[model samples]
Target: MDDLTGGGAPDSTGAPLLDVFMQGTTFFDMVLTGLPSQPVPGTEIHAEGMGSCPGGIANLAIAASRLGLRTGLASTFGDDVYGDFLWRTLEQEGVDLTRSQRVADWHSPVTVSLAVHRDRAMVTHAHSSPVPLAGLVSDTPITRIGFVSLDEEPEPWVSRAKAKGAKLFGDVGWDPSGRWAPEELTGLGDLHAFLPNSTEAMAYTRTEDPRAALMSLAELVPVVVVTCGGQGSIGIDSLTSEEEWVPSLPVNAVDATGAGDVFDAAFILGTLREWPLRNRMAFGNLCAALSVQQVGGSLAAPGWGDLADWLAGVRHAAAAGSRSAAVLANSYGFVADELPSHPAVSLRRAVATIARMSDA
Candidate 1:
């Protein structure tokens, strides 16, 4: 990859052809846990667990890296203590930071999350804005798949990346404006896949039905997927006029943060392996469910061992000829026959690494 850091061309250091190059915000997240209830004014609440680590797109990059994908990140960071922590954490995770920038006199974005019950509430402050997309992709070698948001106007960089044969994957955030303007999707016409939650897709398309939303978005992009939290996800391919729906896997969720990002990473993995769209959504759902059963967003992401264990259970059920298991087998057939026995990092090691990074 072309070196955006001016250090040199990115060394082979096991870096693949920029499998997933993400451009977005990165946060330094400080987590507080074991709270009995929400805090009141002038009250002191303590937690059993407290630590910090990288957040935002770093979650996605870490999730993809754990899944054994070659990942690169392009975003700006403040030249502060928090930025130093984030940089060290990501580098230890083996993520490529050649495209990242550290700006002077700025404070890195930070989020303080309070964990209650099975969810969390977060407060964030960002002191530095992201580097423009054009500058990020200017002379750098584009990854096979480039991820960006369509929340704003179509940027010239989208077409520039596509011109170099990179497939674009588009996602969006909540429209606080509530206008949910359709023109916001104007950039998707040049994208290869559009992935959004049911609410965002429905609101943007002005349709309450998920299938309708999927089909509507399919008109603008070749591939459209609408993730419906518990109802599962819906996908359609305009090229073949094919549609698929995958039900969500049942799991006791401890934290739903970063589940969507993990799902995106897994779905992109499926796409890279040429798995059928149905399987992609199923895999995404399974991985997302596994993630929610843990704490924190990025920290909760599953590793290869987690996936293998889950697959082992599914295969055991499939061996008993269970109907639901049979259906899952059809979708996850690759796992039984092709998945590796070990993960790049085991859960124990991942946790230990997080602990180390948090303390740093």
Candidate 2:
């Protein structure tokens, strides 16, 4: 097992088992916001907001870590400047990358996201050497759960991880081939949960209705969640044969880059905490909604501090006992109590709120 203290720094050796072990790619994302208009051949337009951070799997890992989940990320990083920055950023977010590989002389993956009023256009460039999923799975520590994508086969490692008592959660990307065949989920029966967007689920299951897609997918996995942007999310817990829906929170979006990934991270955290299916969906939706209000993918992901502040603000606003307040308090009862605070966390929340207001 790799050392938990990445740099050999002294810390608690009795720390809990990794809550969510993940295998995927990480990127250094450059965020350019307030682009007055899309770029033209020779037009030069400066952005009002600029920021950079680690993205992709880093979004999921850092989001989970910020939500108080102990996370481990397994992937290859380059030995370049972007790599250094990304590595440091993930470390600062408290993600364990001890099992991650670093390639010499390789440039880290990078993405330039141009934010244009609640939407974005991203251009990404990755090294020719693809992320070795097989190697990452082999390097994962025995954790409560593991996360991966279905872009590759989950063969021996996924099954092996399950046999060792780790729950496997999976996600999928859009298929340009339009094959979207159900057979693509051949060996995924071992997955504890499968979270796919509405379009992906409908396409894969060949069902026009999201509910039908959820029910059909529940037969293949223990848990199936279909995220419907704006409309909300629908999920079914096969073990209990219970189905639930959670509406998306109302929020002004600035950039919707990694909202889905942040939702996945929040779901993983809720699952680890043994929250009810409804609570999990609502929490996940809240986290994703909060993410889009910020700029960069990873930077936009809300931490526990953000969650606390949001809940506090919601509670304080709901003090008048309005119907909406009553409903929100009842739904988020799990987080209604007081929470610990720190100076850094407060500062982060203050800055994020100011940015969102300015963006509006």
lDDT of each: 0.76, 0.76
The digit string of per-residue lDDT tens for model 2 on 246-299 reads 998888887787888899988887776677798789888989999988877877
**Number of clashes found in candidate 2:** 0
Q: How far does residue 70 in candidate 2 sit from its true spot (Å)?
A: 1.1
The candidate that wins on TM-score is 2
Error of 2 at 290 (Å): 1.4
> Which ten residues in a row are the worst by lDDT in model 1?
1-10
TM-score of each: 0.84, 0.85
Model 1 C-alpha lDDT per residue in residues 1-360, reported as the tens digit of each score: 122112223534433467778778888877776678778899998876565667888888888877777788877788888777788778867678877788788788888878777567788877546455446545544577888888865556557768988888989987878999988888888888999998899999999888899888887899998999888999987765668988897677655677889899888888877777887888889889998776667867887778878877877898998888777767777766546543345542223123444554
